[model samples]
Target: MKVTAWNDGKKTYGIRVGIRNRDRFFNKSWRNIEVDIEGSIYQFKLTPGFWKHCPEFRDSVKPTIREWLEKYNLVGWPKRKPPRFELVQIDNNKFRLEKYKISL
Candidate 1:
């Protein structure tokens, strides 16, 4: 699975995941996965299908997305105020959380 991210110019960004078979002919279309980055926090919503395609990312997706945002300077760091981190579960399997620290 290959993950790619892009901004939508509406204070929101999108992540696309692509998978290809070894034969190089069986390629699945990109899957639009919901993701957002605020300061040092990265939030991602992974569905059961998404997890099935890229389960390896389950534990490292947050940091990986954060790194991508930071590499492109997409996230901002505020020195005067720090944002609070919270984890809210949308359901039994869906939730959002904030992680990582943004440097000043």
Candidate 2:
């Protein structure tokens, strides 16, 4: 997966994820959501008055690409892994990245 950031011209910024193979079976697209980036750590903030949902990222997000690495004990960014089946599940789940075999 890849993460990209775009500033909103003030101190605000939003993030749209490039999930390798996210079926999106349980979540919506990560568009228009504010995200904070600190090196390998990624954070998400929900605007006030908006209904919070998502069991994984309901209120806010403090996700790290490292966590995913820890979960799978893999090395390198989108590389060095023998294979990630979950990512495949995501590919089958989502239709955005039909060709997601790239190196960073």
Candidate 3:
């Protein structure tokens, strides 16, 4: 598993997670999970079709996602609501969700 921070211009923006090695459940290509962070909260969107392929998506990935968020100092920001997430999957035993706009 690999975690990468993405930036636009001078500010750190979001993260992309990539995983190699196909698990027993999924095979074909690598997998990626994306997270968009705004202030101290993050969000991931999931669709029904993705759930069909991997029912354990949230169970398998949420902890790692939290770890990555903390590692980047992107968690626990003062916000009106807590962070939100959705379940999704990719080819690798890994998964990635995507896209967010950040304020400087």
Candidate 4:
């Protein structure tokens, strides 16, 4: 599964906090997660909460994007035939529970 993010030029763009196993209680594995930005700054994931679902990342260490995505459990989303807006407007977007799509 893959997600497409747009560069909004507003506050940071396209970054998302990975939703963990939502059904479970607190998880410590978040501490090991990483983020990578262009400048080589790194970030780590946090315990279960809004931080885990951040539309813009709020971590301390920044790892490579590849590493960040590797730890994330991706939810599949359909590609928009023609994006309606210059930037993706929503924070986390929406999940189609009745269907099998995660819209970003």
Candidate 5:
């Protein structure tokens, strides 16, 4: 997933789940999820709707993005250039996100 900043520059942000992985949660219903960013736990409710083809963690998910950026030291990077994190599914409701830095 990628980090998103609001178009109006209102300091709003969200984590947009990729379409390829959205199908992992096939229930198509609102479900509670606990995401582990580093060691912090962020809680979010998976939105339920047929129109929402791509699952997004908005509103209450701002902290997740902030913590992720801070944890990964990507705070001052250019716009739309943050690396995508790997979201690992631990179970039906638990997930872990991590960004691996490549060393050349």
Candidate 6:
């Protein structure tokens, strides 16, 4: 699945969830999600309302994810088109978030 970066016009930054896929990775009740990036596991939440389908990284773990993205130059600024990445479900309630690179 493709994940995009987003900012709330403030210090906060997160992944944006677009149309929901037919193959569901998350449950309908919308519980907290855990994603493993590289080796660290970050906690994310399903924001209320229309965004409930996408999981937003919680503040407690926001800086870490942001730093990792920045370190690899994989992030896009708020005004420009946000960077996109690949999200893979490795197991139940478990997923791996990865940066995608295209080859010529």
RMSD of each candidate? 12.4, 11.6, 12.8, 12.1, 4.2, 3.5
Number of clashes in every candidate structure?
Answer: 0, 6, 5, 7, 0, 0
- Model 1 scores a TM of 0.25
- Give the clashing pairs for model 5: none
TM-score of each: 0.25, 0.24, 0.26, 0.26, 0.65, 0.73
Superposed Cα deviation of residue 75, candidate 6 (Å): 4.5
- What lDDT tens digits, residue by residue, belong to model 5 across residues 1-104? 33232121444345556555676553455476787877877877766642266455643636667655655565554665545556677777677766655111
Candidate 2 least-lDDT 10 residues: 81-90
- Candidates sorted on TM-score, descending: 6, 5, 4, 3, 1, 2
| Residue-by-residue lDDT tens digits, candidate 6, 1-104 | 77676666656676655556313566656556778989888877655633445344434444766676678775556466777778888877677888876111
Judged by whole-model lDDT over C-alpha atoms, candidate 6 comes out at: 0.63
Better of 4 and 5 by lDDT: 5
Worst 10 residues of 5 by lDDT: 1-10
TM-score of decoy 3? 0.26
- lDDT at position 16, candidate 3: 29
Write the residue-wise lDDT of candidate 4 on 1-104 in tens digits.
12243233322223332243222322344443332233343433443443434433332333343333333433222343211111121212222111124233
Error of 2 at 47 (Å): 5.8
Instruction: Give the worst 10-residue stretch by lDDT in candidate 4.
Output: 82-91
How many angstroms is residue 6 displaced in model 4 relative to the true structure, after the best TM-score fit?
11
lDDT of 2 by residue, 1-104 (tens): 43232223333323233332122332344442322322232334433322232222222343343344335443233423222221112232232211133223
Model 2, residue pairs in steric clash? 21-90, 21-91, 22-90, 23-90, 23-93, 23-94
Residue 61 of model 3: what lDDT?
30
Q: Residue 45 CA error for candidate 5 (Å)? A: 2.1
Q: Positional deviation of 13 in candidate 3, in angstroms?
A: 20
Model 5 misplaced regions, further than 4 Å: 1-9, 48-54, 59-62, 76-80, 102-104
